[model samples]
Target chain A: MKREDLQLLQKREWCKGCGICVAFCPTKVLIIDTDDKVTIANEDACIKCRQCEQRCPDYAIFLEEASDV
Target chain B: MRSSQLVEKYFRTKNLPHIWCPGCSLGIATRSLVVAIDELGLDKNKTVIVSGIGCSSRAVGYLDFNTIHTTHGRALAFATGVKLANPELHVIVISGDGDASAIGGNHLIHAARRNIDLTLLIFNNNIYGMTGGQFSPTTPHAALGTTAPFGVVEQPFDLVKLAEGAGATYVARGTAFHVNPLVKYYKNAIEHKGFSMVETICICPTYYGRQNKSGTAVQMMHWLKDSFVLNTAYDKMPEEKRQGKHVYGEFVKKDLPEYVEEYVGIIERLKGEEDA
Candidate 1:
């Protein structure tokens, strides 16, 4: 993903590629991109379980309200 | 509340990226703590967080509160002093397994015995991650560690049992994988009037996982999920089914007179007598 697309997701810089969020995502909605950081490969596949939000060590990825857009 | 919101509210944003290794459970465990504090609507000014040296102790630096990073294994001792000196402050001691049970073991039992109004949260990763993987007191029997290259022969200390035996008013156990219940345990522990200890079983992915072949951080979390059952459900399981499995829940909760209250009463009584 390019810099601007990456900036759209909140706290994306904090992700350390621990893989906890990507590994635990039930829908396989996330993937570690070539940059070794998490990028949403399939946003539509996200179930919004928030398990990733709960277990992320870096607080890097979380669900933002659609209204914030 | 949103994790981002909790981060903005409770953490020192300047230290946004923590020093902890990637995939460490300390972040998850630490998140539960802030969540508990937020859920309770505790006054940030009145809450004091004290910690001893370890990965868990590093949390104090990132949190936005009155925090103390004390000497090794002296977290509870320092917390006791904080509670006694202020009496109005809500003192919370954050310690690792080695910091709490190994080095500061004496202080732990004594604080529990005194029944002080301090909350001790033990982030038990089973091994000493900060020192490059030495065997800690909570390392499970036969677990691999640098010191126990041949495997640990001695039985590990059950922190819940130790706290309960030492007369703590509240004692509970939770794991990082079980974040929701862990937050509840933390909340209840803080609200308890007397000394309370909540042990959160965390993961040391770099050291413990690699040494024990426990797989990646995600796999270790799954291990926690599969190995530990809730206390209520654990009791109903058959003996064969319970083997190798640990239980997590509030093992003990009872009312007890707090140490500060008793000490204050003594001072008040003596002052009244002198006036007469």
Candidate 2:
């Protein structure tokens, strides 16, 4: 799936700011925000590979097929 | 398609925000198993999750399925009874490095030797995380643990090698960083009809990390990515260079008759002979 066609969902409370997702994300789409939680720093660059989802030990982040709001 | 949906569909919602320490890779490994089970379209009622004592053993309580939370180091024994009684259940045993390789070492080998139809997932964090960071059978030599203040002197178990040597029909190794491949191995292990095991290298920041002076959770994850070589590439590395490195991949997959099947065959033959 294309990055533009995906929505990144972050459960901020569950994130411990472990950057395994960032290390695996080929697109550099994620960053540990000031709060020590994962954030989509580059939404447009996301490749929708779901590496973040797969690597998240917290079950804190995921990708969903974008739904019309 | 939604994160909440994944959680609600596959997990027992009330039991989560699981008590696992933040950055513990047990959650990551558990999710891979969940994904494998979901993708396989297995019947939840017929699937059983069995676990023995340890941090990883707590997974049975969280996963939404028929689960057996057995005593320390005896999960395989309990699971064996469960599988033999029903023979139709998909039994999966989740155990810690200490629980599976130390106290339960005998059961682990015998189950594999018998070629039982079960998926034995070893959540190997090297140290005994739940028990105040004691050194486990899989702890790397010289790694610090609460019990090994002077640095561990004994050799560690090569878990995949042990499983293979014990006659497991399918054996694989995966680290927490390699999530997708880990999930694939979980799926294949579950599908295999004989004794199958996947040793998942996990990060225990609260124990192994602190004792070893390993960096933060993120850094530990990077270490996991670095410390293991794929089985294919490991073959070419010289013997000296291969020391302290793990080889991750499926070591074996064979079409072998499972324990339950052989037992049932004997039962059927006995019945026929009695009639004659």
Question: Ignoring the other chain, what TM-score does chain B have in each prediction?
Answer: 0.97, 0.96
Model 1 lDDT vs. the true structure? Answer: 0.91
Highest lDDT against the true fold, candidate: 1
Residue-level lDDT of model 2, residues A1-69, one tens digit each, is 566766887767777777878878889998888887788899888767888888788778887665631
Q: What is the TM-score of each candidate against the true structure?
A: 0.94, 0.94
Please state the error at residue B8 of candidate 2 in Å.
Answer: 2.2
lDDT per residue (tens digit) for residues B126-210 in model 1: 9999999989999988999999999998899999999999999999999999989999999999999999999999999998999
RMSD of each: 4.0, 2.1
**Interface RMSD, candidates in the order listed:** 3.6, 3.0
Largest DockQ belongs to which candidate? 2
Q: Model 2 clash pairs?
A: none
State the lDDT at B49 in candidate 2.
Answer: 97
- Lowest lDDT 10-mer window, candidate 2 chain B? B1-10
> What would the per-residue lDDT of candidate 2 be over residues B29-134, giving only the tens digit for each residue?
9999999998998999999999999999999888899999999999999999999999999999999999999999999999999999989999999989888899
